[model samples]
Target: MHSPTKRHALPKSNVPAVQPTPATTTDLTGFTPADSSLRGLVGGTPVLRVSQPFTSPDRGFWAKLEGFNPGGIKDRPGLHMVERARARGDLLPGAPIVESTSGTLGLGLALAGMVHGHPVTLVTDPGLEPSMTRLLTAYGATVDMVPAPHPTGGWQQARRDRVTELLARQPGAWCPDQYGNPDNVAAYTPLALELAAQLGHIDVLVCSVGTGGHSAGVSRVLRQLYPGMRLVGVDTVGSTIFGQPARTRLMRGLGSSIYPRNVAYEHFSEVHWIAPAESVWACRQLASSHYATGGWSVGAVALVAGWLARTLPRDTRIAAIFPDGPQRYLETVYNDEYCAEHGLLGVRPGPEPELIGRPDEKEVTRWTRCTEIADPLAPTVRTESIEGGRAR
Candidate 1:
């Protein structure tokens, strides 16, 4: 499927006002949304459309310079969620902003907290990137490390429980509750707008589904412009979002055991399951080829995006979202030895993987193994999820 160009230019009546002009408008040409970097942070990112030998040039696959942000693509929603919450009176004065972030959201909350003068508390399990924990801590947010349980209820649920308890203890504590917060969905609206502006038009958006915040919000807005738009929900095989049996996951920030109400599954045209090993390897490949520092989820999305870029028709324009930058994943996915030892180094090296793609290869995968794509209409919550590797 191909992206259709805007038949008419957006008139002055319907355009966002540019960010306040600085005293000296030196080299800044484009705009960076408060949430993401369409235009990168000072000297950090540049918007460029790459032409790769592996994909069709006319189709023009574009990736925003998210790594250019202080964090990455998820920064868009991360900041948006907090700013919106404050504007809506969801946050109270002197109340700590609380959330269970595997990574990027915490950074977003940190940035937003700094801008607005509030304290942020992050509750995460051991599987998260140490760098992310440090990044948030460096931003002055309190980090509470919750130990993951064996077999299930690993740090994910623990963090959730921790947030609940913390809120109870501190009156007026504002738990952003990213997983279910509608603001999470709303945060991506501007991102969708940016995508439309940068890419001209986007036919299919292949993105990693974590809290489903990025996908739900971006896809909804894009749909209005491109009704034929296809939103491919890419979840790690261990995540429970799409009625899958829960399993242990290594990739953080991109998958969840719970189907958050914020994740609007109905907007999707289809779902493509991703494996953690594939994600890690693809991430490394991205660095080598594109010179871009891909995040954990970016590597996963890139793996699938590469597939769509190469195999899809010449007319198809595919836009993919890579939420966080690679800096956070230095110890895990981006490490070569880590990839090799985890059996995620390459495409199995040999046999043709069955249609299921060898879910047994990794002890830690993104989603549960039992999910099938047949029921696209299942209830978002009742469909299935596992707090402890249980997808029910």
Candidate 2:
């Protein structure tokens, strides 16, 4: 298990610590910050205690700063999957890797490819941010952008199809189908252990569901340690992950038009769908008060986590996973112009959660839930996920 370096330690004053940077010009001092290996820096991310804006009793809620990982939370799974594949002899030495990702997982795959001596090809749609594109290319991974969305299943399915085409063209290519691969779910064991070490006892686990990888992986391990812990799955309003109708989602990384097979829906005690406006409000509030924030999913998870902290018992310990940093979302979630353009700014947070009783229900526009948990796509559509059993 890879243990991340300790970080996000708070000062006695309760103010966010300011990290010192080297001067513009190098001083004559021989002293240097220690950083031995790129792979060594992968895990051991800090768990930050959120202070302001959350007045709930006890440790209000802890934000696991996955952004501290070089490539964010997905990095854990990405590296784990690659290492496991190589160990199992499924990925031959020096074989090229191919996969479909929006950004976070793409970054993780790029890092994994780099560490494992494999070339990487990431297939994504045009919706991918420019900064992510450059970063992936900088990591020596080839970026393949599908020109358009699929008429039926939308961009995600199109990207998967493109991955198939690319794999056919490049012989001996390995595609880590993050959506269905069980390895994706197994990749976060170390993370769960880290959380156990950090908090000791976690009463509530709030996570944003994307490919349903981290939520399923980490929550499973945590549940073993804290059997009474409640797993709260957060998602965007348009996401179909929680049986909500699939529509155009402004937020990335948490919602999927196509239901991912990796979602351990049964593990989730309850689910919440946050709109873009609500996420914007939460992200900005976190930024101004706590000086910590991320993208849409981060904000969504934080919103739900904060609510859990406030509504639950005073002793309840909630841990929310923040997948990455805010730099990538500067032009979107953090940008005033972009938020205004999308009418996502200054929206009041959360209306109410409506009880859901059936899977075929419609017009779910706000927070919604159902007592039962099952895959909405189970009987209707057969998934095109490659590597059905492996964790990637």
Candidate 3:
């Protein structure tokens, strides 16, 4: 009989142990422990190479693990937007900072609030994970949940309405308005520079589109360095951001119910709409194989990046941004029961995406790709109207 395969174990450390230092008196090796030091920890995240299972053995992509930052990728934008607002006198000192978020940005805003001495109030909907709500409160952010979604715009718009109400009630309050803010798109310049330094060259950059911040920001900066680089945008099946009809979206961190003005539609070479099941399969696969995974956005982007690795020229270098880690998804994406309840378990994405010519082609319901991207809000494009014939 064949011997049972042995499980690999980590090698024991050989370095001699040093005596523990007291927290009050110990000197940090490379880090300075100060209130201001927290903001300093927001960037310089490392990149990881993912191969095999996710991609062919000889082909892979570089993933910028933005989860390494204190509060994930948005920490960069959260701090930058707040800083710029203060500098421009748009936000007064010690003023209340109000904004709407699904979850990820709430954490970032909380961090920004603590760092900048501002009070943060995040408006969200019922879909936000319980862990995130508690964590935001723990971080000293006031959490406000909208009672219901808007008649046409859904939960995102409902949260926005609540933000407006809150802003009106509080004097000297400022909202980040991440969906349309230029600063949000500009905040990822450092991230793009980091990717260029880490990968040397990037042939294709894949990103998930929510507010269209990071994708637009990073690609804009990277294109300046590598003019020939291609940008691939990933969105959920139900997101209206890519011209799909608005529907309930299960996944968060990416996919918007509204057409965010920050989306650089002209920059995209193609866009993919991924379903919840496909994202679940990808997330699980990444966790089991590479031991590095994130929530919906990460999974969707990875699925697209892996396909690109397999189909693109052998010499092509692809970079995917993982917006955040899996710690916040314990109740949903990573939970077996939750997956079963939502019919998101045991379904594998097709090796190749179904192709379409335009973003509005037949309302994509699975892993579908489109090359002809356009701003759905553009006057030339024909988009269905909502709320008594008002164009969304």
Best by lDDT: 3
Q: Candidate 1: global Cα-lDDT?
A: 0.67
Order the numbered candidates by lDDT, best leading.
3, 2, 1
Cα lDDT tens digits for candidate 1, 21-60: 6687567678555745322341223444544533555644
lDDT (CA) per prediction: 0.67, 0.82, 0.90
Global fold similarity of model 3 (TM-score): 0.89
Candidate 3 local lDDT, residue 353: 95
Please give, for residues 158-214, the per-residue lDDT of candidate 2 as tens digits.
Answer: 999999999899888898899999999999998999999999998888898989999
Error of 3 at 49 (Å): 0.7
Query: What are the runs in model 1 whose C-alpha is more than 4 Å off?
Result: 1-60, 150-152, 346-392
Tens-place lDDT per residue, model 3, 227-325, is: 878888999998999889999999998998889999998778788999999998999999999899999999999999999999887898999999999
Q: What lDDT score is found at residue 79 in candidate 3?
A: 90
TM-score of 2: 0.85
- Give me the displacement of residue 294 in model 3, in angstroms: 0.4
